[model samples]
Target: MTALPRRGFLTLAGALALGVTGCQLSDPRITGGPTAPPPRPTPTPVPDIPGLEAALRHESDLAALGKQALAAADRLQLGAGQRAALGWMSRDHGVHLTALLAPHPAERPTSPPTPGPRFTPRPEPTSSATLAAAARDGAIRDLTGRLDAALVDYRASARGSRGQMALLWGSLAAYARAAQVALVRDAPRPDPLVVPVRELEPWSDAEAEQQVLRQMHALVYGYQAAIPWFRRPESQTAYDLLVHWRDLRDRVTRLLRDRGQTAPAAEAAYALPVQPTDRNTAAELLWRMEAAFIPFAGAWLAAATEDESRRMAAEALEEAARLCLEWGGPMTTWPGWPG
Candidate 1:
């Protein structure tokens, strides 16, 4: 290299400094890459079931009925608490309708069902009629009927659906079942089953079955540990729950054997988040164990294939949610899919 003059040397140094400082060291963008905003992601298409539109319509109608009942409750001066009780259906049914309409939002009716212009209440002469029994054109009865009908639609929709759709309908059915139980304490409870028709993730039916079986075993064990620690009534409740879980475990075991899958052996004891030192602690432990089923049952519902199995799973999920309340868990909008 030849020696350069002072001006040339200064210019060359300046050029080098510019090259070093002015250029970005960042990774170069690909020829047609992230420079332009990524094409707006196309939303994944939701699955459409055969009877889903009907389910959506039913939810709309159910929501309307709930609104009317709420209005009637307000008209009768049923108090803030009673008004709140009547309001859940109005809110919950909106969620039900949205889930049903997810596959094709356009199918939503232009004019959704509406509560009529005015509310009418027929208070009994005895002044003893509970809000539940009030006859506003048998509005309470109609509300009950709508919930029952929605359950029917949810079940039918689950049958026609697969994967996530099945799970969605099954969850809705379970929640409806819970609402029915809440309304009428004598509503039929869920029983064990051979299997059901769907699951959200594409897992083996046997795999899901085994999971619930193992969890049920642990729950039964947990209930047994807690029963002795609870107070009189709660102790009885705990005992009853233990019995149910024990029986469910046996049923699950038999099902697994019938399917030729090796049933998992229960541990001598389970490690739990809560320890049963006293009544409150025991109850808390038991509550958590039961609450675990809400989500677990939803996962199982995703894989259930037969109608009976689906019903069993759905009801199990609902039962778990109800039990959580009994065990002093706070109210949650969505139990299985908890926030």
Candidate 2:
């Protein structure tokens, strides 16, 4: 077919007729109020994972028991270290179960689909960071009894590999017992600088900023139980690498006090803030810590032979610091803003 000239092929301009237009009567149905009644609830898909649920339940129960023990110790004013240990144990186990169960497909259906970003306020300076604190405390109150019992039993024992291991475990456990008492009487709080603003709730605007400080104190001190293990194996580099972790911990604790002094709350509260500028700093610090841990951990692992598992413990300690620094630090400034 012959093609039309360029001018002749010009497109037609569409026009709306305003003055003269044909109209037809229309019928419309109007609905009132809201929509239909809510539908029946769906059968929750409880994941039948082998032992997962049981473990979660068991840990939860243990944590509850630990909390009770902690409370009892507080009432009796005894075994502070045991109470603290119990508190730590409780919080750790609870956190562990929370993480394990958080990913189950069955769990997803029961909980509402997370529509948008869910913010968690950094923990606040409270009576204790964990139920393990209580357990630790309880253990301490009865330490005299425990130590007396251990000493009585130890005099009759002979030395062996198992004995050495038991001795080490016993010494460490005793140290932990001592620590629980100290922590309970004078619990170290978290730093305020690191506390997120979201943690403060039901507080007036003027007092909310103080919540941030309270949260920092609670969080930094929360890592107290685990952080010191890195230095015990006699490694300066390991300790140096942990400087960031230690600094962050100290910083949070300091911040909490500073902020609290500036803004005191009627009661202790935590608030994780979502400030873009602050988040950026937190993200950068986390990245730095992660980058440092890889090399530090390698150094510890390379020297793992012939020595007591001190090297292994050092490696583990480094890993723990790294993880807390990475996941527990400001998470808002990530791949993208959370919904």
Candidate 3:
């Protein structure tokens, strides 16, 4: 091969060097093509709302106390009935704990905070009546106080949260209220005239009316089942409940009409979960019926469009829950979100 002139050789060398530099610059890793971007510093998770943490901690503390109370009852060698009652109360606390610990989008730390020290139940009383009454009273007082505080936290959290979280907090507040009634074997007649404001999510008028209609249908069925047992003198409470149910049904019917929707017709009959042979059995059946109404009423309350309608629904819910307590239903942590 003939050697090129110096000028031409220099030009050729420069071109080769430029081409090599271009090739080096095009390496895939240098340009982040087909290579993962530098692992973005893993973002720190946002902390949970202050109210949420407080509620969880409270629930954990209650659960620990419940466990201690149940153990004390067992050690006291209480009667089967008494022990069973205590067990019911303890179970409510367990349920509260489960709800508090359940996975939430806002959850952080992956676990609940450590609960405070376990409560030590008072020693068994000398008198059986004293044990029954005092133990129940003490348990009720403790649960009701804690539950009320939890309600405050939940309500505050609900106000701060959006969408489903708000709904969850409101429902939990209602559950706490129902549990309070259940703890009191003799719940004083809730002020029949005092109506409460129901916390509702934003919904269309049609949606709200539909929910109200559904609740009315539930109350109608409950009334039908309970009215038959009103023959007994002891069924006065049941009679009162029937009248209240009718009032609620009428109110909902009017609400539907106002919204230009038709109220749903009640079924001709509903199958009773248990046959009633006596007044006590009848009360129990009614209690079950009323308990069933709570969630439906709560749904209505949650969806109600007008404040008046929401207030009525809330009152109806409280009435049904109170009646259930009168008839011997166990206190539960989630009355409106029944399994």
Model 3 scores what on Cα lDDT? 0.52
Best of the two (2, 3) by TM-score: 3
lDDT (0 to 1) per candidate: 0.58, 0.32, 0.52
lDDT of 1 by residue, 171-265 (tens): 67766765543443322222211121221344577787777777787788778888888788878878888888787778778877987998887
lDDT (10s digit) by residue, model 2, range 67-105: 665666656464544454555544533443343344442
Count of residue pairs whose backbone atoms collide, per candidate: 14, 65, 0
Summing lDDT over every window of 10 consecutive residues in candidate 1, give the lowest-scoring window.
Answer: 7-16
Q: After superposition, how far is residue 136 of candidate 2 from its true place, in Å?
A: 6.4
Residue 256, model 3: lDDT of 79
Ranked by TM-score from best down, the candidates are 1, 3, 2
| The 10-residue segment with the lowest total lDDT in model 3 | 7-16
TM-score of 1: 0.62
lDDT of 2 at 46: 43
Residues 97-182 of candidate 3 have per-residue lDDT tens digits of 44445444222112232332321221221221122323655655765777688778876775555444544565566656665655
| Candidate closer to the true structure by TM-score (higher is better), 1 or 2 | 1
Off by over 4 Å in 3: 1-50, 74-82, 85-136, 151-163, 186-215, 224-234, 267-271, 330-333
After TM-score superposition, the amount by which residue 275's alpha carbon in candidate 1 deviates from its true location, in angstroms, is 3.9
Off by over 4 Å in 1: 1-48, 68-88, 104-142, 181-202, 229-234, 276-283, 306-311, 330-339
